[model samples]
Target: MTPARQKLLIVTRHTPLPWEDGAGAYLHDLARYLATDGFRVHILWLAPHDRLRWKKIWRLPAPFARAVRLHLPGALRLGRRFVFLAVVWLPFKARALDRVRRALNTVGLAPPRRHPSPAPPAAAPLWASPPTPAELALVVRFFEKHRPDVVITNYAWLCPILDLPALRRTCTACLTHDIGWQRAALSAPGIAPEITRDGEAAWLRRAALLVAISETDAAELAALAPAARVVVAPKACETRAPFAETTSRSLLFVGSDNAFNARGLDWFLREVWPRLLREVPDVSLHVCGSIDRLVTLCPDGVAFHGPVPDLAPCYRQAALVIVPLLQSTGLNIKLVEAAACGRAIVTTPAALPGAPFLRDAVAVAATPGEFAAAIRHLLDQPAVRAATAARALAAVRARLAPATCYGPLAALLRANAVARHDVARDLRVLHASGAHPPQP
Candidate 1:
C-alpha cells in the first residue's frame, strides 16, 4: 500500500490571500509551491473581530443599533485604544470581574444572561496578539483532529505557538522574514536593543529549524541560535515575459505602509525626486500600494494610486522601477517582483544584497544625486533600459524562480520530519529500557 501523505500546518498571522504586504505574498507563494510539491497543507490564522458586522449593525433601527453597539465587545465597539486595553489590560485585571460573577452566583441574586452568538462577519482581520486561552484551546483542538506532521510558524512573533503541547512531538520550523530585533530597532528608535535581541534569541531556540529569507539574516539567526538548524530561503516570484521597449518616461514605486517604505519614499520625494524632475522635465513618478496614508506631503509630478489590485498596468506603463530603500532588513520582495516583471530597476546597494547575482543586471545608486542620475539615464535611453530589464528577467528566472528557491526549504522540511522521527524513536527506546534521555 502507498504511504499516507504527510500534513503541513502553517500557523500565520494572516490568511495569504489578497496579498497586501510582503509577508502575505511570501506565504501565498510558499503555500502554493508546497501544495504543488504534494504535501497536504493547512493554514491556521488568528481571525480578528469583524468590522463589516458593525457597519451592518448601523443599518438597523436607531434603538436596536444603539443596543447592538452597546452590547458589542469593547474592542469592536470602542476602537484601537480600547482594543489594546481589552487585549492587554482587561485580561490581567479580570479576577475582580470573576469574583463578582462568582459571588452573584453564590447568592442566586443575578443569573448570568446568555447572549446569542453574533453572525460571522464577511471578512475578518488577522489577529495580532498572543493567543488567549480560548484561542489556544481552539488550536489544540485543531491539532488533535488534524495531527499535522510538520508545523511551520510564519513569523518570529508567532513563535509562542511552539509552547503548545500539540507541537511538542511535531517537527517545527520558524520562518523568520528578517531579524525581528533589527527591524524593530530600525523602525522604533525607543526600543531597547538588548531586550529585542534576547526575545528574538529565545524564540529562535524553540524551533527545530529556522528559515531566513536572506543569507545575511541566516547568518545572524545562526549566530543567535547555534543549536538550531538555520537555512536560507530567499523570496521567490513568478517569472514573466520581458517588457517591450516603451517611450513612456513614468517611474514606478510600489510598497505597503511599512516603516521602511514610508521613510524611504519620504527621503526619495524630498531629496532625489526634485533632482530627477529638474534633469528630466517630463518624467513622472507613480506611487502604488497602501502608502498614501503614511505620506504627509505630495509633490508635483507624483501621482498616488493607493492599494492597486493589479500591478501589471503600472509595470507596463513605466520605463523604470525604483527602490530607494534607506533602511531595510531581509529581501525586498518588490525588487524581485520588478525583475520578474522585466522592469528596469534602479535600487540602492542596501536593497541589492539579497539578489547579489543581479548586480550587473540593474543599476545601483547610494546617494540621492546618484539615484537621480541613474533614473534620468534610464529614462533618456530606452534601449539601455530594455537591455537591463531583459538581463534582470533572465537573472531572476534563473535564481529566484519559485521552484529553484523553495526546493531547499521543501527538502529541509522533509529532513526535519525524518530527524524528528528518529529522535522520538530513540526516546521511546530509552523509556522502554528504563534509561533517561539526554537533556539540553
Candidate 2:
C-alpha cells in the first residue's frame, strides 16, 4: 500500500525563488524533497530580503497592512543605523587611521604628538525590538486562514505568530538557526526585561518541537526546555562535480556577505596567506563570493570573481580548499562542500568542530602560523594532497548525507503532535481544580 500524504505549512524568511543564497537554496531543496516524498506543502515566506519582488505575487490587503504598521517606524530607525555602522563606521575608521598615520610619518611626528586610531563601534544590539502587536496578529490571521495541519518555521521570530494558548494547542515546529532572545541576551550583557523575559521564553517552552542545526545548538535548547522535543539537523548541500585540481599553487575561499566569513577571510589574508606566499612565489588566491569590499582590501596578487552560480570552477582550479575560520558559532557548509567535491582541506580547529573528517585524516590548524604552515606543507607535496582529497570525500559521504542528518527531524515532528495532546489534558485537569486560571 502507498503511504498517506500529509499537509504541511512551512514559514520562513528566505526560500529559493531565484537560486540566490544559502538559506534560499536549502529551503528550495527541502520543499522539493518533501513534496517528492508525498507531502502537500504550502509555503508562506516573508521574503524580507527581496520584499518588493515577493509583494508582486501575494499582495496583502489593508487589514494586514495595519498590523505591520506599528513596528515600521522602529524597524526603519534601527535599520538605518545598522547600514551606517556597517558601510560607514567600520571602513571609515580603518581608512581615517591609515591617513593619520601616513601624515604623522611625513611630518616625522613623535609618539607624543601622534594620535592613535579610534576603536570601531560595537555591532548594533541584535533583535532589540520585540514584534509589534500588528505583526503578531497578522501571523495569527494568516495561520487561521491556511489552517495547516502542521507548521514549520525557521526562526524564533515567528513565535508571536504561533504561541497563542489556542495556537499552542495545534502542532508547531521551530527550526532554530539560533535562539533569538538567548543570543540577544548573550551578545548584549543586559537588555530590557520586557523584551527577553516572558515574551521569548514563553514562546520557546510552548513550542511543540524545536529543530537545532548543530549539537551545540541542541544542547542550548535542551537546557532551556528539557521536556520539549528537539532534534539536531546538520545542513547539507546537493552534490556538485569534483573540482579538478590543476595547480599545486592556488587556494580557494568562498562566502557571500556574512560578517563571520568576512572576518575569517581577513584573518586568512592578513595573517596566514602572506606567510604561505613567502615560501611559494607563484601561489595564487582565488576568491569567489559577493562581498565587493574584500576585493578592494585584498592584496595585489589575489583574484576576485564576484558571484558565480556554479562554484565548481573556483574549487576545480585550486590546489586545496582553505578554511581558516576561528570564531563562527555554527557549521561551515563551505568546508563540507569542498570535502564533498574531493578537494584537500586545510582548516582550523574551530572550522571543523564535531566534523568526523579530521580525526587523523584532514589537516588541522589552531593558529595563523600553524594554518600557514599546513597550507605550505600541502602545496609542496602532491602525494599528501591526493590522499587527503580521497579521505575528505569518504568522510562526507559517510557522515554528512541528508538522510543521516534529517532522520531525527521526521521523528521529532511525529513526537511533537503526541506531546501537545498529552499536555492539553493535564492543563485542563489543573484548571478544573482551580489551581490555575482557565486560558482562552
Per-prediction TM-score to the true structure, in the order listed: 0.78, 0.69
Best by lDDT: 1
lDDT of 2 by residue, 37-150 (tens): 555666664434333332322333333232221112112223212122233455678798888888888999843356566987543323334345654555566667655556
> Model 1: C-alpha RMSD to truth?
10.0
Model 1: residue 425 alpha-carbon error in angstroms = 8.1
Residue-level lDDT of model 1, residues 199-317, one tens digit each, is 88887788889989988888999988899898888878787566666788899999888889999999999999888888898989999987887987789999999878678889888
lDDT of 1 at 391: 89
TM-score of 1: 0.78
Error of 1 at 118 (Å): 22
Positional deviation of residue 382's Cα in model 2 after best superposition, in angstroms: 2.3
Top-TM-score structure, candidate number:
1
173, model 1: CA deviation in Å?
A: 0.3
